[model samples]
Target: MDAGQIVEPPRILARRSGDGWVLYMDGVEPSYVRRLDGAIERGRVLMEAGKVPGVEHGAVLKIDLGDELNQRVKTSTQATADAHKAQVAAAAELRRTAAALNEHGLTGRDIAHVLGVSPQRVSQLLNDQHARG
Candidate 1:
């Protein structure tokens, strides 16, 4: 086989050996085909050889598994972005609600009790313009 040239109908053949299985291709031993006693073994043999038995010229390139590192990085980035956005939104809502409660003659402690947050948090939200307000 020439380098960089893809083999077509890459042949894989399997045969039973002593208490196990042996896999081969073009009379070359590739690997040991294990646990072959039924249809599962047959499927494994066929898949490894890049061919579907009983089907003429049936071959397909193996599926490309995605890069684990790339997937993890993308997931991490999206999660961080979503968390930041949620934090900003929650802070803005807290400030708005605090202002409304203040208009109704509610103290920071009362607003905290109604909103289920700490009184210090309510004070921070009301006093600090940069605290998501």
Candidate 2:
């Protein structure tokens, strides 16, 4: 099997002893038993029924079943690209605003305060625009 592929066998929940996790199947088929044993041997925390085991909180578990993972990866990449585009747009707008402010004799610090960004960032924007030409 490929990496990140979890063969779904019949699984039962069992609580771990003193924050240890164990998966106790009702009737252990050969395949299921092998996987379960592998999981256990791998030091994976198994949760017994009605037991609170400490899993890594705030961890993002991405289970890709069917085409869902591929679709999600595409969507996420698109979102990241869109966000970067938005930032570039915003930076361009800020440069325009800074130019207008400069034309009106506004200081970089004043422009930064108005734009709610650091004065250093305002300077960088101005410098970047100058560099493009």
Candidate 3:
């Protein structure tokens, strides 16, 4: 995230960085969302499903540029989440491929070599797969 880049606001709570004024939204996933329609949709769905205890429609305190959370913090959180999600997915796929190679009579070392990863990484991948179950 670069300086001056606008980010998607939090769905729950926010405080204006410039004025220190707090803004809140009421609902309960789209709970506290910036989008009124999203909140209403979630509430309606929950109510229809009898999942929510109660529902509120289209309530908002204020919706600013979403300067509530520190920009750096928001950037870091989003970046970390994105990186971890990608890593989890990629690691799972790599392990699946590695297992397939192993089933084809490839040694762990052989799989590692073909996959351009460390032999230890092959073990890690296998361990991760076992852990998943």
Best by lDDT: 1
The C-alpha stretches of model 1 lying farther than 4 A from their native spots are 1-66, 129-133
| C-alpha lDDT score of every prediction, in listed order | 0.62, 0.56, 0.61
Q: Clashes in model 1: which pairs? A: none
TM-score of 1: 0.44
Report the candidate with higher lDDT, 1 versus 3. 1
Top-TM-score structure, candidate number: 2
Displacement of the residue 28 alpha carbon in candidate 1, Å: 40
Model 1 C-alpha RMSD vs. true structure (Å) is: 14.4
Between the candidate structures 1 and 2, which one is better when assessed by TM-score?
A: 2
RMSD per candidate (Å) reads: 14.4, 12.0, 13.1
lDDT of 2 by residue, 89-127 (tens): 988888888878877998999988888889999888788
For model 2, the superposed segments whose C-alpha errors exceed 4 Å read: 1-65
lDDT (C-alpha) at residue 122 in model 3: 95
Worst 10 residues of 1 by lDDT: 56-65
Clashing pairs in 2: 13-49, 14-47, 14-48, 14-49, 15-48, 15-49, 16-20, 21-46, 22-46
Per-residue lDDT over 43-132 for candidate 3, one digit per residue giving the tens place of the 0 to 100 score: 455443543332333222333454554676778889999999999888889989988898799999999999999999999988877787
